[model samples]
Target: MAEEELKIEEGGKKGKLMIIIIAAVVIIAGGAAAFFFLGGSDDDMADVQAVEGQAGAAPSASTGSAKSGTALYVAMPRPFVLNVPGAGRDRLVEIKVQLMVRGSDSEELAKSHIPLIEGTLLQVFSSSNADDLVTEAGKIALREQSLRDVQAKMQEIAGADVVEEVLFTGFVMQ
Candidate 1:
């Protein structure tokens, strides 16, 4: 009876030992999981800080670009009117615009090409109907044609490829 009681007590102690070991393992595993998923302290935020610094350094590069635009503005000509085809019957029938243009080639670039661009635009606008001069789609189409016409005219006048883009400073239809 004594030996049997001793064996029973030893079995209880073994069970308690197993419980302790399991609890310790669970605690260690949970701590490791927490560190792996949610404990990223400063390394994650460093990337964002570095990106902000890089973006801050770019303004100096853009500051000089505004000065270059002064010359472009001086060379740009008057606004041209495109009479909408369907506009005769509608309330808003005209696309009035002022163009800001530049050249593609440095040597071929000439401020004098503004007249040629204006002339080409006058012809292009006059040929377009109301449907081609009204609405968002019409506006985009007109802008594209204006760019093409200006570039073509610039090439013809300077005897080389010139004119980059035509910006619409004033775009209104009424």
Candidate 2:
């Protein structure tokens, strides 16, 4: 009976040891994962701060021309509304666009040409078909076309590609 008691005690000690090891592993893994994800966010925050600092420095560096290696974004004052041809009836489409430029000069240039840009965008939007706007590829194509037109116009006015990209902030079709 005494030998049997000793064996049972040994088995209990082994089971307890296994549970302790497993718990230790789980806790260490959780800590590692937390460290990995949380550490990444700090890096992201640092990157954002660096970019902001650069943007702030850009305007101070140059007045007439934009500083190299900086990005600027300007939003249009109003959305563009147009009627697109549909299967049976006309579909109304509204889009809000933002202009991505390289520097302060580009941003100012874009702002100065807002009216001309809006008119050009309206012409492009009006030419689009209702069915084409529904698909992802169609939306991308439309954006590309708009960007090309805007850049062309900007080149004519500013003698440079003031507008880098046309970003669609909002799009609705009904």
Candidate 3:
């Protein structure tokens, strides 16, 4: 009977030791995981700072301001009305366009040269075919062409690409 008691005590001690070791391993693994997830390395912080600095310093053509990182849109004073020729008869197309500019200087330049820009845009619009304007691809191509034309003219006057995109605010074909 004493021998049986001794064997039970020894088994109990072994089981307790195994439980303690497993608990210790789990606690250590949890601590390591928390440290890695919560404490991001110094390199990550440096990369974030570098990106913020570049955003402020670089001249962004898409955004209005390097400091604010916002887009600036300038609306044309008047809508453009052009006669688009068709196979049977000519159709009148009216469009309202807004220019997306980057900086204050570009905005001012665009405002000042509105007349010249309007004339250039009108020339491009009037040359389009009425049939082509009915298609989605044709409209997209027209918008692209307008952007190129406006940017070219702005570049000539401002010595840089002032306009980023030409957006059609309104389009009517009659």
Candidate 4:
């Protein structure tokens, strides 16, 4: 009877060991599957490397003739919030902006001058009336004005168009 009990205990241990091994195998397989599905593709890596190469070269200026490495976006650190005069009453306005650049150099340049850019955007946004902001055409005109002003400022500082677009990712007026 003792021998029979010992054999039973050994069998239970073996079953547990088998379960652990199977669990390990399943976990490893899941990890490999995720890696394959989520890893960056070769094309993405090549584009990143190309941009890095251009930035590392330290080009004197990003001229129109130079190839734009990649489209990159730089987000302003904070949203612009201010009050604008309306037809009836003053309303609070908030705008979140992102700058799109053609290459790494432009990205860096824009990042370095974020304060200036923010100020420029604030000036443009504050100049608008709340009533006009209610219309789609007014928003488009504001965006165009912002882009032109930012580009002009960048050109003054860097002698190149560092920002390609001024995107209003978020806008609210109340």
What is the TM-score of each predicted model, taking all chains together? Answer: 0.46, 0.64, 0.63, 0.65
> What is the C-alpha local distance difference test score of each model?
0.57, 0.83, 0.82, 0.86
lDDT of 3: 0.82
After superposing candidate 3, which stretches have Cα over 4 Å from the reference? 1-53, 57-69
Q: Residue-wise lDDT of candidate 1 within 2-112, one digit each (tens)?
A: 999999999999999999999999999999999989877687789866765654422222122211222233334455655455645533333444444331223124455
Clashing pairs in 1: 84-130, 85-129, 85-130, 86-130, 103-163, 104-163
> In candidate 2, what are the lDDT values of residues 41-107, reduced to their tens digit?
7678899879877666444222333444468889999998888997778888889999887766677
Top model number, TM-score: 4
Using alpha carbons, what is the TM-score of model 4? 0.65
Ranking by TM-score: 4, 2, 3, 1
Q: Per-residue lDDT for 6-80 in model 3, tens only?
A: 999999999999999999999999999999999999999999778766666335444434233235789999999
Put down candidate 4 lDDT per residue, 66-166, tens digits, no spaces: 23566779999999999999989999999999998876677888899999999889889989989989999999999999999988888898888788889
Q: What residue pairs clash in candidate 4, if any at all? A: none
Q: Which candidate tops lDDT?
A: 4
